[model samples]
Target: MVEIDPADNTAPPAGGKRFAPLWEPPPAPTRGRPARVNRTQIVDAAVAIADERGLDAVSMRSVARALGVGTMTLYSHVPSRDHLIDAMIDRAYADFALPDPDLPWRTALETYARGYFSLLRSHSWLLTVNTWRMPLAPHVFDADEAAFRILVDTGLTANQVVETIGIVRQAVSGFARAAAAEIADERDQGTDYEAYWSAQTDFWENTFDPARYPTMTRLWTMGAFDDAATPFDLRIGALLDTIELLIERAGGSGTAVPSFDECVRMSGPDPAGCADVDTADA
Candidate 1:
């Protein structure tokens, strides 16, 4: 079962006015018996269903059954399926731990990326949702705020700040999505990424034309195929290096900031282990 979000915010969300009803729930029914559950409870139940089975299994009827309430009873709380999903996505995002304001900018992003990637893995069903249509819910905006806050004080301009955050977030999103899709599909497919790829071993070892793919052939010969996965920080640290160059180009302190390796090493983990960040404490 999924843990329920403890946020009791009652203020209207700042991003989307039409989504206000979800943020500001309906007043308790004054004419009839009060609702058996509030909107949060309904959303929590639906999230549970989605987590266990998948998003496709989370409909009004399925959630109603999980909550031990009738289908119409859910309608009173969640006006529609669209409303429920928008709430669900935000609820999952609420699990993200925002960076502490006192930390250095690179450290803050490290904290944010690790936490966000774990959240995506936990709720991999989120990958299937049409996120383009997802409402600009409170937590979503808060996440965007956390990213902006990290870079706002840098000498980079507004456009640079936005692009930098977009790039970092997309990196986390794309990598985690590739990793999660393999795990989630194992439910019905009965084979994971490693197992599925092993099927092509014979062709790769014998039939493949190494002359046509020189670099890949070299990598394969070096036992690089022994573990095809690239470590996360190797890529992210390189990104940080580029961003540092950008900061220097903008007349800000670039090399003054500790490298990802330096900060991470000071924080007491093996540098390579940064890729396996367990952000429960984030």
Candidate 2:
């Protein structure tokens, strides 16, 4: 038997130092029952609601209804409406199928853009998906990580890579949302964009004085042509080209910008030469 020391609270009976309190761990967390709400399932239900009725239609109550659970149950998984939207955005991002790493930066970036566009199209409410200043989720960080790796390999600084990724991500989502809005507008009006443009042109011709607006008259005539380049292509292309130029100047290369000849060729193939048909801002 060990000797006990009166002054040492931890000493053993025979004089070996006591170890019970010194080595004991705090108790494990054990509440009455495990949490009933599954966070993943709650987010999934919210995404389904957004897909069916757009993001505006999504509400905590609505999601709860869809899940056949009480609103309080959802709150157990997600804190607020904003939190739900954030979760929905991440869930939508989870749908992206990442490109191969072996591809060149240009190809990889384009693949990323296309994959993102497809995701937005599938989840049209993506425009409302929050990309807060500080994103905490896995999907958000995964994209940033992929972009950082790809751009870093391209010889860009960390800040440059981050800036470039932001612009690219915005461009892809903006393009998709713009296209979705245009399509939605046309569907709501029960007429195609071309028909609406014709009506607008008739109004323009009737309201404007030709002598005072020669330039407008000239543009109107040229714009009516099926062979004319559409404004959508021009604007979006111009914006992209401007960014490409910036990147080129900043040390990047091999941008796949379309040549004028290529544009002409593409226009030559389409029935209306949709190239000439402006999307009224798509």
Candidate 3:
């Protein structure tokens, strides 16, 4: 984990510094004693529990056990369970590669949206975290700043930039949440989707009256549910297309943004393409 100085007085232009330095490392141990642990280790342990068992399993006691320390010792580093959760959320966001600024606004947004969806899917418990209750952490702020920076320079007003990013973020999160639910359902059933749905064929044929539900019968016959990815792919593509239209209506050329490949090359050696772009201006 990166250490930031909590005492630093510098503030970003956006709204007088609403978040504290939650990722800062703990004070070093005194002489003759080994350093017990750091905030990063605690957050990592908590996140591991959440990823393996689920969010509800991530109590301070559980994390302390995982770290081979007493539960009270965790408080000295994280303050509380809520603060530990905030750190976990921030750590997840930090995993994201910041959007390449040189890419066109659309490409950059697409890349970010896909990455966000992937993260949520991988860590399904993340969807359960109440983001509204937690102060913005550095990694979360970095994502927002990168998205805003890309869209802000494209002739959109500040409000428009904010709204646009909100739309994209909501779409990605919503889709990922639904996908996670579907995955959980399958796991609980101990069967794949096709096998489970096939077992319900008798119910559809007998209970679902064909005369009253013509479209339903047609869809069942066509095996529409067999390919879950089609609907998700189509919806995401349509959403991106609509956003492009909105940009054009605002008198901005949708093609003006650079390609993802170009941004990668510009970032040389680092595939994440997160070179020092001014996030504060966003």
Candidate with top TM-score is 1
Candidate 1 has an lDDT of: 0.74
Tens digits of lDDT, candidate 1, 1-282: 432222222233455554886567677778877778788899999899888888878787778788898777876776667677888999999998889988998889888887777777778788787756667688888888888889866777657887898888778778777776656577679986657777988997788898999999888789987755532221477678888888778875332333356548656655555444443332
Query: TM-score for every candidate vs. truth?
Result: 0.73, 0.60, 0.73
Indicate whether candidate 1 or candidate 3 has the larger TM-score.
1
Listed per candidate, the RMSD to the true structure in angstroms reads 11.9, 19.9, 9.4
lDDT of 3 by residue, 1-282 (tens): 222223222233244223464545556567666758777798899899888888888777788889999777776677666567767888888777767889888888888888888788778788887756545687888888788777866655546777888888788778888777777777897886557767997897578788898887788779874654621342577777887777778775333333345446667656456333222332
Q: How well does candidate 3 score on lDDT at residue 217?
A: 70
All candidates in order of TM-score, best leading = 1, 3, 2
Number of clashing residue pairs, candidate 3: 2
Which scores greater on lDDT, model 1 or model 3? 1
Q: What are the runs in model 2 whose C-alpha is more than 4 Å off? A: 1-37, 198-282
